[model samples]
Target: MCNKHLMVVLIILAFDLAVATDSGLETTQAGGGLENRPQRDVSCRNHQEYPHDNICCLSCPAGSYVKSACTSAHERGTCENCDFDTYTEHDNGLLQCLKCTKCRPDQEIVARCTNTQNTECQCKAGRFCAPDQACEICKKCTICKDDEVKVRNCTTISNTECKRQLSTSSNKSGAVAAVLVLIAGSTVIVAFLKRKKKFVGEQDSQNPSEMEKVVVDSGSGLSDEEMQNKLNGRLYDSPLLEQAQAVGQQALANKEKETKQGNSFTSTAHSSPASLPTLPSAPLPAPYPHPRPVSPSHPNTRDDDLPRKKLVPLNGDKSLTDCFSYFEEVDVHFHNRFFRRIGLNDNAIKNRENLQPEDRVHQLLNVWLEKVGMEASINDLIAALLHLNQRLSAENIIAKAISEGHFEYEGKQPRDESQL
Candidate 1:
């Protein structure tokens, strides 16, 4: 039974080996057929199609042109350099090189063309290219406004840039307005000063007695007895009444003496010329000094022919300073006018006038202190006085007052009137 089993196994193994040999023979035959059969040329499929020597072939690379075709299939063609101004961007089988692009009128060549590349173009100067628009054509730059200034000039790649003119007209207008205001202010000040001066002059010229008469007339509704009582009281207390009384006494004595003299002269005249005492004749009066010599041609020369009076300096004795000192003893109203004449404001004078007469000087000093600050000094006061063209007497009064330390000051000194 073992021998029979062994024989069957041997038969099964031989059959299996024969089958495997047949499969191997079939695979080898197939492989041999594939290797021996004519292979398809894949070179033409992978590369650009080109005709060479009546057969297909690979085309030439960039930067060069085909000079001649290859002699066989799947071979490269003979290539040569492209001419200047001509180009081919890719591997081509073209018979001739392509012509390079020309720059437009508004464009310029930035880079020259090569066999492997085309020409590069840019906008010309004073022009620009917009990326949003077709770059085939360039546009002109925009102009700036008349009132605008150029912040950046136009360039081939950028448009013009501008900015508005700043502060020119506004500054000019401001300066003009300031000048006009100054002129108007000065005119108003001058007019006020003139009017005040005229009013003060009129007040100064009126007699105190006349002013009293006007006052009494305004109160005319009083009874006669009341009026007489008021006049008696005023006459006893008034200095003007004392002066009038003294004048009346002197006039009565002169009249009595004149009457006695007249009677004596008549009696002497009756006694005859021989009785009159002989008197020495007085020497002839001396010829007048500084007699103006009349011109021969001016036969009708008179005393009026003398030269006109010479103009004096403003600071001389004849100027307003001589009159300004008179205000010291005058009424408060006159003092107010004096302050205004010297450049103090009316409101300040009014305030000062409201104070007691003894305190008026202190008030004036305070006003000056406010205007000039703490730097008010003797020198500064002198400068102000000189600017006003005051006389020596007025200057002395101020100097004395300052020396006595009647007022205090600090800070910067006062400037001249022109600077003010």
Candidate 2:
């Protein structure tokens, strides 16, 4: 019994060794399914694909084109599509690397839009055939008056046609053609009338053979008087309406003729009759030297033909330096000037006007500060002066600033408006 137990234990040890060997083989062998070359973290994602996913370029197939390019070599944006007008073939490994169709001058297309395919093409219904022109549709034929020339012919895709009657031939040929047309029209009318009558009256009573004769013969099936009456009615009853229509038609034909001649040499779009005329362009505005200042207070009026009055630069007067004194003394000087203008009485002026020269004096100081490029430091005073009348005397502003404790305007080594 002891020997048997020893053999059993040895067998168990051998089985365990075989199992470990098999696991090792599976890990390193190619046929081991997951047998490895290298190991990596499964949670790690590719960083280059931040915005886009699935980073492989697919090839383009034949007969279609790409309209757009991929955002990057890795990130594919939506593909631009092609219609019947364009074509592409080949495994375009991209959404946007497609092709547009090559259309002949006379050809046009109707398309079904798509991202990855070519649209379809068919002949336009109204287009005329052009030799060497790959046309999808034919344009309708234009009808012109006998004396008219076709300045521009219509194509199947477009409705515009130009025609004009340059001159009429004076001869019997024109009259003959007109007469023949009238006679043919009258005959058709008479025949229709006769057929109607015969179908209603004689056919009701006659045998089939006799009814056939009735159907064939009549005074053109209508009386001569009836034909004349219809013609007269058309000519006399609607003359005004017909004349107006004819005039309008003539005007349109003339305009179309002119347009065609114009476009033969020049290629461009014309907006409309009311569009502004194309004149020689003025010189471009330069960025520097500044633009003209549009003053709010304009003089009363001027005449178109009168010579323009130029504004000579108002250079600061040399004496303006002495005139910079402000506050009490400055006030006394401008006070005399204001009353002199107002006829010495406040009642002479408007009811609520401020008579104190100091009010505007401080404003002027601000302007002077701003002119010297110190506006950022004294913007408030400058702004106030901007609203005041330009005619206000300068001395008054100094007085107001001094009295208001804004500055000492009395005796100072300062430059006048000119010197400053």
Question: TM-score for every candidate vs. truth?
Answer: 0.28, 0.17
The C-alpha local distance difference test score for the whole of candidate 2 amounts to 0.40
- Which predicted model would earn the best TM-score? 1
lDDT of each: 0.55, 0.40
Residue-wise C-alpha lDDT for candidate 2, range 1-420, written one tens digit per residue? 999999999999999878767554335545645643222211222322222222333333444344444554454434443454454544453344344454444445666534444554544544566556655545565554445455664654444454665545655676877777678767767876886676456436522222121122223333443344344333333333333444455656756766776863234335454442332122222222321122214322112112222111122232222233442233343343333332333332222133245544443433343454422222222222222222133335543443444544224434243210
Candidate 1 least-lDDT 10 residues: 207-216
Clashes (backbone N, CA, C under 3 Å), per candidate, total 3, 44
Candidate 1 residue-wise lDDT, 47-77, digit = tens: 4867554467778888777888888787787
lDDT of 2 at 50: 21
